[model samples]
Target: MSQDERPALEDLLGAKHRWYHVVDLAPGVTTPGWIDLRPHVGGPQLPASLQGQRALDVGTFDGFWAFELERRGAEVIGIDVDQIPPPDTPQSRWAEVQAELDGAVPGTGFELLRRWFGSSAERRSVNVYELTPEAVGGPVDLVFIGAMLLHLRDPVRALEQARAVLRPGGRLVLFEPIDRKLSKRSEPLARLMIGSTIWTWWYANRACLTDWVKAAGFTDVEDLGTRDVVDSTGNKQRHLTLHARA
Candidate 1:
């Protein structure tokens, strides 16, 4: 990119970025996102080659996973509530950088990168509760939900929507934070909701997570294992990834 493009690129990024993928937007120029999620992209869990497959990325912030799927030869669609404009109220949860930019859009970051990379992956403004086969137009071969469930008020409904959008025997890959202590039990599906100080809704234990997924119409569910992710503050959070078939 030339000198003229830098201002626009800088304007597009959120000041308080909670980046989960380290994306290199241009030569010698990478998005300042700290999390390197590429390691999990082509792993046994994610399946590197999505050639000729139709994939849906739930809650795809900044289009990282959507672009990743496209790079692996899949036709992808990314949906996120962030694609819509926030309210004008003082308590509206708009990003600081978004509030600062002139003519800023909710999905500007994703669009900038998409145009920069010349990708064909599509993105839409949609919430999880509103997801359905009819709303999405058709069922897809793969559905990927990464790190978004815990924030939802109704995860079961979201999972149901995910299931609704998958073709028979299609795959649903989920990566979420697990409350490890609750994994020891085999009874009730335990979920811990964070304090009102944050926007998080429920943090499900491994057992609970699996149970909910199964209840959502997934026939086969596998717990991939607990992986640790570090936050911007260097604190580690344990997350579990699951693979389920609808």
Candidate 2:
């Protein structure tokens, strides 16, 4: 059946609805259902993740966070670029994402709208730089931008778009990895494996982030990359989880 004809994925996974059954996933795949998505996903536990409340997820690859919010009873809408290469490519991450969610919470009550970030976003990927909050139906309660801000050529403008759609007390949760300030190993990897040398999206400095988030009109900005997290290469890198109110 076409996407329009199929029942909403969240509803199918909801316990209150019929045909309730939680799907299971393996390691590295974490798609959580309504039973509880907050502890693991960060913002899912906040007041914003609920039913009737509205949330806009920018650069949502496979609707992972969207589904989690939906399961919590929030009226969630997710937009992403629908064209991912192979299941193993960067695009396939969400396939695993949905699968894991389906495994965790089978009958969630959420809605997924396939679109992008631009003024004329369709059922595909979006150019975040060109995407506006007005086009997505503004004044949403919360806006989630995960692992997407650093890629922006102009992140400040993007935050402006977010502010345009956000309510007076709305919040923005940014999850990204930052580069190590005093680490000697990080510099070489950026040059060789990461390409182009230092300062890729995989990493950012505090000053740069503060300047951008503040410029975007976000108040009480906090950069929480005070520690290190282990990467696939068995090394620890500086990472951040920031929350700011608009």
Report RMSD (Å) for each prediction in the order shown.
Answer: 4.8, 9.8
Candidate 1 per-residue lDDT over residues 1-246, each given as its tens digit: 552243455654544444446787657667766565655554326777899899999988788788988888889989887532222212344454255443645665566677767777788877878888766667899999988887776788889999989999999998887776676776645565644424566778888888889889898899888787775568665678899999
Q: Which stretches of candidate 1 lie over 4 Å from their true place?
A: 1-20, 26-28, 39-44, 83-104, 184-191
Per-model TM-score on C-alpha atoms:
0.80, 0.58
lDDT of 1: 0.74
How far off is residue 50 in model 1, in Å?
1.2
What TM-score does candidate 1 get on C-alpha atoms?
Answer: 0.80
Best TM-score among the predictions, by candidate number: 1
Residues 82-193, candidate 2: write the lDDT tens digits: 3322122234244654553454422122222221111111222454554566656556788777656655445688788877777887888776555565233432222112
